[model samples]
Target chain A: MALIRKKIVVKNKQGLHARPAALFVQVANKFDSRITVSNDKEEVNGKSIMGILMLGAEKGTLIVIEADGEDAHSAISELEKIISAEEEK
Target chain B: MIELKGIAAASGISIGPAYKIGKEELVIEREPIKEQDIPIQIQLFEESLIKTRREIIELQKRIGLEMGQEEAEIFDAHLLVLEDRMLIEEVISRLKKEKVNVAYIFSGVLKKYIDVFSKIEDEYLKERIADINDVGKRILRHLLGKEKKSLGDLKEKVIVVAHDLSPSDTAAMHKQLVSAFVTDIGGKTSHTAIMAKSLEIPAVVGVEEATVKIKPSDLLIVDGNKGIVIIDPDEKTLQIYGQEEERLKGIAQRFLSVKDAPAATIDGRTIDIYANIEFPDEVPSVKLHGAMGIGLYRTEFFYMNRKDLPLEEEHYQAYKYVAEEMKPYSVIIRTLDLGGDKFLSQFEIPSEMQPFLGWRAIRFCLARPDIFKLQLRAILRASVHGNLKLMYPMISGIEELEQANRILEEAKEELRNKGIPFNNDIPVGAMIEVPSAAMTADILAKQADFFSIGTNDLIQYSLAVDRVNEKVAYLYEPAHPAVLRLIKNIIDAAHNAHIKVGMCGEMAGEPSFALMLLGLGLDEFSMPPQVIPELKYIIRCVTFKQAQEIAHQALMLSTGREVEEFSHAKLNEVLK
Candidate 1:
């Protein structure tokens, strides 16, 4: 299992809502790995656009992205790019 | 002709066939499923989800092709909702546990999700509840094998009839194809009114059973000027309305000529003409109509059309934008006046026997200082942007006025501690809507810097008549002896107390009532921007002395009908 976990400060001004959240979910769905994202208290399936949005992570919010399975490394990197990019990827 | 009455929302007359919009409520009863049927139920849910997804994509593609991609992007949120793994899994899990029909379980789960989202304080997420509800309805319709009508993709112009038009429904409306709107439930300040005014279309709301009475394509006459909708009018009546519509167009052109003139009586008494705006989008139109200032900048929109309470910054930003836009002219904002006919589910405002007489306006604000002070603080912060003033609506007496001011002071103190600069001496006013407030105008005027008579509620409170009830609509007369007497006393009290009195109501905008109100020494008149030029024309045409004389004669007459007739006659005579 190529499990990967990394933390990143939300760089996009709109946090993970709108186009950014959609893009993150779309990328997460492409992975053959189980992906999850967590704020401080709760973790949710990274493949859910609603879950990402329901987190209500504003700009500068610290979130951890975790992926478990063979393509975990790639999924983590791709999802991380969405939240880290100042503009939509 | 069968006539039904409602509150006059946006004024004008339109003759068109009816297009009834039925209430979109799908009742679902839980039916037990056997253990063997669990897989079948799951399949049903999955198929409906797939169907809903395809329908949304088709709609998105069509809307993109027709209205451009920017407008079609609103459905992106809906698509996310349909594909939400968390939501779908929860429904399937609950369906197995509950052993209930898939449709019932699906709708129930959707309700829970909606509850969770609505409870979220984030404004962006709060806005998403509309999308969720929209998508939820689509999925349920598919599961139940039912189809419901939506206000979408209209082929021709028609008068829309509905039980109630929600914020989203109004937003989804084909503005060009809908000639007018008639709804079963809503007051003058409801969504229908706000949308109708912004759309510059005629609408009659609170016409009970309008959706029931008018069939699709029924020939109709919607006289928003009188708040009456006639279904299946005969030849003569239709001809009369057709001529009246033409005449009004001519009058509109005539009014445009004097739009830029100051509203002054021939005998030299000047009345400040202002616009009553619900939101900032109307500011440009307010200027076009030559309003000297914004007299009643209603802040209720913050609470309306959404689930969560707006953040203080939202209020501050909007108020600041309007205040900056109307720099020299004063903007009088009426604070959050919830309850009564316009109650929010978020507040859990109870159904009252007489909502208008129950907890509302300043009463509701006084009880909820946490909510009230947040708004007050925002208003205070935005006060520095221009000539901004604030007023409390439905203030019945001195106690409510003082309590409200005490909270305002607390807001000021909070701002002061933060070193936020605001207009320290911002003028504070109290809206005289209740009879008690009108009777004690002198006492209120002591603490109040000014008074804006909200004649809509004043006439309702004075006559003890429910404004929305068509059976008693005749009793809800603005020119009733009791109503006029209360108004006279209020104006007199404000003048005696050295505070100016203005009116922001339907009565203030009516051309027939303009002269009498001028005679009563109303210092200001605020209404929908479209009515400003017409009222200004009436004010400019008559001498204040002549108006006073008309007022004197009209007051001597006992009935509201007589007073109205006299005012109409005098208006025609002055124009001649």
Candidate 2:
């Protein structure tokens, strides 16, 4: 399976912090796909809360996310949309 | 037949049926499942999680629509915690290991997390745990075969009796049905408390066990003035409370009608009464209360209520709006006072042991010259439309005052170089809330065009007691001999320099203290817009000479308690 990956800058004022990261996870859980997000040095299950929190992606911090599944293409696109939308507020 | 006492959070009372929000309990029937049925239970749990997640999001959006974003953030955080894989996977792992039904396992795991968060010290952040587990329980119930999670209809004009209300719970409450609230958990500064008061709903918080004893739709009376809750009250008791409500309401209406009336005493003393506004929407409330101007226009609301720093244009619009509305009336705008409990997203400062005594207010502004200059430029531009005066908060010494003035001077020079037209004649002032500022008021007063007493922080820092702490709340008496002496000292210092001094704290709104303030020779009194009429009535009935006499007598008392008792007694004697 091919894994789609990208690093995005958090544009929201509170950082990609707790609430927004949780929101990203909730949106990621929608599709029947396996997703993982990583900061510079660590990788975590996108659906795992401790993993997202451990990522600690603050405002202006670049975060790399990866998705691997039959639906990885659609999942990566959706995940990118969630982070870039600036609508979590 | 029983009476319960609580802290009087707000003034007024209501006699109505008790409307309990009731804890959001999971009510699902569980049946024994064979070991082979574990897979089916797991699938059901997944389905329920999806549906519950959607419902929780919808509820969160609804709350955001109702109460605004700051409150939405509270539930939004809870929603994240609810979806935590750590929590969900932990339950799933237990289900697989124990070979038990998913519903029982989920319920137990949710209970464990709730226990953990309930023990936290910070009340603001601790309330989030209740919200998180509440949604978790709802999901578990759905998996166990419960189809509905609905609270029965509330009575008309009810007072919601609860242990405490989450931000989500309070947001969902029907304002038409729920006229007031009496809760076991919360204080005046609690999020729910601030919400209730902001909505003008009579709320009495910190009533222990109010939800447990008061039955649903039971006739109840909530006395916010006296901090008493009466359950199943007799006819006479109900009538007395009803009459009192009517009287207070009549007074309120009368005040509303004359809110725009010029504030003048019967003895013909015209005192400039202004409103202390936190937001721009509150600008109209100032006019409704007949404020001659906007006294303490708190710019912090813009910083505190949102996630992002307000842009220069956004700041200009808000300042311009109030300045335009109050056209000829002076709108005293304080520069962005960030620090203490109030934080801004733009400034990066380390958290301190004593934030009130740390790099906050004018200190933060002075440190970031560009940020400080941007606000100064905005205020100056807004001043062109109205009588605008810029003030700085928490000024301790003349050096800080001079340093701040230097930045303002630099802003003016830049604007001048750019050929931008701003009100160059705008008056600058400082808040004399710190003891050092008060002690050296003569020096600071010379630098400042005027002085406003921020008594809330003044009393807190002076007495070293957080007014919110129940243990030391009694020490929060504003009329403490030391506090009164400080006020007298500041006024004397300001008057000596021909500078105006005003009060912009809770004490300014209180009727009894208005007389004492005038007696203390305060040139101005800035309070909440709603309190202007009552204070005006009190001010008109008494003369400055009489107030001075009573205030003089009060200052002679030995202890804080004696001063309070004597002042209360003397106020009644004079006002009558």
Candidate No. with top DockQ: 2
Return the lDDT, model 2, position A57.
64
**What lDDT tens digits, residue by residue, belong to model 2 across residues B39-107?**
887888889888877877787687555554455656666566666777778877887778767877877
Tens digits of per-residue lDDT for model 1 on B1-576?
798989898999999999887767798988998999999989989999999898888877765554444445667878888988988998898887889899998888888777766776654565466678878888998899997566876789989888877554765667789989999877776657766876768999889888888888999999998999999998999999999988887777778888998888898999999999987877887888899999999887787534368999999999999999999999999999877766353465544667678888888889999999999999999999999999999988898889999999999999999999999999999999989988888888899999999999999888888777768988888899999999999999999999999999889989899999999899999998878888998898989999999888878989999999999999999876
Q: After superposition, how far is residue B139 of candidate 2 from its true place, in Å?
A: 5.9
Give the fraction of reference interface contacts each candidate recovers.
0.34, 0.29
For model 1 chain B, give the 10-residue run with minimal summed lDDT. B63-72
Q: Candidate 1: misplaced stretches above 4 Å?
A: A1-89, B1-249, B305-307, B348-351
Residue clash pairs of candidate 1: none
Give the whole-model CA lDDT for all candidates, comma-separated.
0.85, 0.76
Going through the candidates in order, their DockQ values are 0.13, 0.14
